[model samples]
Target: MTTHPDELAGRVLSTTQHPWRFALLVMLALELVLLVCLGAARLFLPNVPLIALDLPILLLNAIFAALLLTRLGWWRAAGFRALQRPRDLILLALPVALLIVPALVVGVDVPPFGKALALLVVTLLIAFQEEAIFRGVILHGLAPLGTLHAVLGSALLFGVIHANSLLVGRDPAFVAVQVIGSILGGVGSAALRLRFGSIWPLIALHTLNDFIQFSASQGLAVEQASPVLLIAKLGISSLMALYGFFLLRGTEMRMWPVSAQSAAAP
Candidate 1:
């Protein structure tokens, strides 16, 4: 029998297990890249624009993701498939909708056209790098643990990793909101990736979400706006998490084909 491409992908990529040692090394490599970027920024580009620093960081992540992909032998699994259902599109848009209220309330200053274009480029890179690592490497590595575990594990890691924002002296309240929001957003993005078998829409939605948030942060805004906005944001995020959970429960009995027997085999 001919296997569907998606099924084949799940069997070939999700079933393959890397050594625990390799997983630890990949996670360590990510941290090292982050430390190097922050160190370089502090030592040399203290006064540079945030994007100037972020661009190099994003580039390093892209390089690391590429290496991880090769090391894991997931070339076929990384294919960007088309969205196959209407629900897939809705899941992709849900995260963007969550940001709409905040964008309206905070409002953004119109930057010069060139600067705005440059900012968009930087945000796109940020989205690419983040999804490639969290949703790509981490998700693939953890798939044998079952979809629920993989989804929640990756999401929690995503949130915890953002704690690094505190090191830059961001307000505690702001960092807390960001970290929580990231965890919630990670659930939705990971579900959409699994459901649609593609990362393109996630990248687009993530870019839009980040660009709006980044613009609002740089523009004029009331100091009190964050807590209120965060409350609303978290509510929406909870709904998203619920939606992803329901979607997973309603789908095929197995999200990936890594059977318990295969998972335990040498």
Candidate 2:
């Protein structure tokens, strides 16, 4: 006999609430798998552009995350629905708008259509992998800690993941700044995930934001930016963080609602 989705979700909720050690281990294992995949790709595909190499690795990671969610009966918790509450969507838009400042200021040169398409695909895959791990798994596992702690904890993990940038030889200061930005973005996206009970919008927004930023980095001259532009970027990042906190204020965490049929299943 088949188990209902709600029944499976109930089991997931119950299981994740206790044995905190196991939950933490699961979280670490997920991140380690992702890191290992990335390392392998970098090691084996040294000649490929990082973006190109990352696409396949991220796709594999997303598949792994999906399988884990399925096994845990929390697959529906992904919240893929669109057309959520207007207020929540509006609040989410604040940071989405702010995220484009870097691309707008630096400005992108039109790349060959093929390269542009490749970048878009890469960014979309990145959104899938990140949202699946950070929001779907980590945030859900930490839900027992209450909304504030879960949000902060998951965001910290998100920031920590960016430490891989150091391996790429990015300046320590630059990677530090990126980590801060990731934490802020994590909070905002996590809020949206909770508020709307969906990760679809976050995926779309993340894809767009990353695509623009990546495109600028590849096709624009942001490396030699003026101090004024740097200051503006920092100011925009601060606003995004403030808006993230604004979104999180008064929010409460709860399990995603299962379907009526699933809920009634016995």
Candidate 3:
């Protein structure tokens, strides 16, 4: 009997000795790349906070993204196609609007024009790379586990991976906050990726949401652990994540089929 694609994926995952470990390592490796990029940025650029970090990040991430996209099969599975349902986009508008609340509540500092421009550029790049890796690659990879496992599992992975930031000099307190917020955002973003069945829209929304927060007035560097700001971040991110779970409440049982190569046993 011929197995359905989803079933085949489930079988592969089931038969694997350490699928979860492999997946975790992949995520860790991805973060390692980012850390390397940041290191390169520091070595070369020296200290323009915005450009120094942003430029190298953009370079490495953009290139890695290209490698993923170049493979026809990988790109298709990664939600590279046009939106499968336009209505989902409309439904997502509400969450997208609410996403900016953290920034508004915490306040924004609007860096000098040049720095703001660089920030915008970097955020856009990050949105692309992250959505591709997390929502696209990782989400689809976990598809065999059914909607709940796949979506939530990937979301947890997304959030946990940010801990790598601490190794690259981010403050421990700030990284803790970042990981919490990331997990929340990941939950929502993963759900949305499944809902829309396309990654582009989420990328756009992620870029906007990130741009708003990173440019906030007090900033993570100074806030350190502002109770008020942390509360606001939790509330906003949680709302979006809950809305995401709502959106995907009882959809496909398990159908995140990947490209031929992606699903292959190594």
Candidate 4:
């Protein structure tokens, strides 16, 4: 019997889905290239704006997501859902709350709020663009592999991509916590896509979470290195991971099909 592409993907994931394992490596390589290119471009031009790269990157990911959906014949599932349910809102809110806890723990610096508008703009741009790329295009491309594989693949990629940004002057422990939190966020985003088959809620949640964090960290000057802040970050990250775990286990039994099990066998 000839296996369908989707079925084949599902099968590969059934045994031990190494999709994220591989995807992260490729994403890291691309990120390195992008870093070099950006540095070189800035060096030569000296006037190129960093934001110039944001929109184009987002557009490319949106295009890639569309292409993947087309390949799987799920092309129509490309945009936002018309009516986001209460549960979706609730799920999105949990992470936002996670973001706020650190602020409460260490107290945010109020001075940045004066420039909150600019901070909000930057967070919106980066968060939506990055989420669309990792959770949309990259995740959708791995969809043929099954939801579990897609989530893992996309989450790992998201984590690694952010790791590059965290390599600078930040605390290593804090960076590690944020990466774990990002992975947790990735899981929630993937679950939302699997349940709703759209990216709007994820996009919203992504933007809001970042906006809250940016506003808190920069605008409010929440103590970044305080022990209290670190605990809150890790604590919330753990909670998100737990939430993602249960959400996945619950959703998988309902949505995955029998074909997923047999697709991998030759």
Candidate 5:
């Protein structure tokens, strides 16, 4: 499931020449287009509500997943192929548990069935679109700049995107806390991709962590006002950020197809 050296060389060359900057500009343009489309849909198509926790989200995820497969191919895009190592799961599970437990402990009020349905829907959406844009396209495109830049760029974008949830009139401090968590989580997830060279496990972990937090909030388990909860959330998130820094600095850095090839020769 490795990327071929020839293909990798071509990608690196194309990116270094003219297309990388062009592609980045194109992506930014498309992002603007998407925003406009969503705005128009909200205004003109008032009746067409996008279900955030239903079949619509699942469908969106499916579409994004398909796009990844098409663009990157089965091997490189599958991400699951790189998730075979045991260390991957261990790294993901710790952060996920830290995020999920305290929130659940506080309690939420949603019914079990409803929670399950919502979790399935939102999890799929988060897994698909978030991972595709952040890990797949952004990180992959920025890989030529070295791993640190890729991690920082992707993590910043991810944090900004997650902050959109604050449009519902959340408190400034609360929003800041959440934004910080997203940055931390994004860095860790980006680091995971660096270590394992895939997106599937990180996608899975992201979906699970978010679902648990959302479910806890809905169920009234998470105490937003509690100092203890805030400390716990921020503490775990900070640890993740530190861990990501070490992971990036360590010698066990994951290699792309070209680097792997170079390392293989005598």
Candidate 6:
């Protein structure tokens, strides 16, 4: 459903005089909170890629989603709505192609059924949380600044948060590669989220992509970022970002939240 012009969260961000500044703080604050939560999660779960590692984040996402619905009786600009146009279905192509790269380059094996199931669940939640906060909250907060800033800002923050993996004791090289990949994926995902005004399809693509990569390692994906793996991701991710920007370029630029909210008014 579309965001109402009077919705508190959207109105607050879009109508605020310093939306750019507010958006920066909001994104940074989100990253900081999630990072600290990850670090704390490791203290208990310790194992990398734990399903529960993201439970807290999911809780946060649920709470945010609930708050918005309570305020407006429907989700607003949070990528909650389903894909609205049949033509938007084409937007999935680049993301899916980008995700398939590592599998083709390095190959993937199906993990044991239990492990695969677990990864599926974990990655689904992760995709949900990331899209909601990154594409949903951050995009809405920055939408007042115009579509370009919202897309770029969310993508950059998506990359930045991957740095938290280093804090969990990952190799710097590996973390660096992850950061870059996240940014590229983020750019494409953010652009598509705005275009399709939905998150379910992106969520599915993200879960499958990560599940394959994680399964490929049989566990060491956490411990290593092989040179070949890094190189393959960089190449494909660059193409993904390019396609995303091109899609964005084809669309007319506007203050997204403001325009959307205004249109929703009867």
Candidate 3 Cα deviation (angstroms), residue 59: 2.6
Task: Candidate 4: list runs displaced more than 4 Å.
Answer: 1-33, 45-79, 84-87, 109-114, 166-171, 219-224, 252-266
Q: Per-prediction TM-score, please?
A: 0.77, 0.78, 0.77, 0.66, 0.71, 0.78
Q: Tell me which residue pairs clash in candidate 2.
A: 79-198
lDDT of candidate 2 vs native? 0.68
> Residue by residue across 1-266, what tens digits does model 5's lDDT show?
86665675565546534424733653564355445545666787767643222344345445654654453433363243555576656766666766666666766444488668867676767677777767766666666666787688777776776554443334456567778877887787788777776677777777776676556445322224345545665787788888788777772433345343432221
Least accurate 10 contiguous residues by lDDT in model 4: 253-262
Q: After superposition, how far is residue 223 of candidate 6 from its true place, in Å?
A: 1.8
Ranking by lDDT: 3, 2, 6, 1, 5, 4
lDDT of 5: 0.60
lDDT of each: 0.67, 0.68, 0.68, 0.58, 0.60, 0.67
Off by over 4 Å in 6: 1-16, 31-74, 253-266
Compared with the true structure, model 4 gives a TM-score of 0.66
* Candidate 6, lDDT over the whole model: 0.67
Once model 6 is optimally superposed onto the true structure by TM-score, how far is the C-alpha of residue 189 displaced, in angstroms? 1.6
List candidate 2 stretches off by more than 4 Å: 1-11, 18-23, 34-52, 168-171, 219-234, 257-266
- Off by more than 4 A, model 1: 1-24, 40-52, 84-87, 105-110, 219-225, 252-266
- What's the number of clashes in each of the models? 0, 1, 0, 4, 9, 0
Over 4 Å off in model 3, which ranges?
1-22, 34-51, 69-72, 101-109, 217-225, 253-266
lDDT of 4 at 117: 66
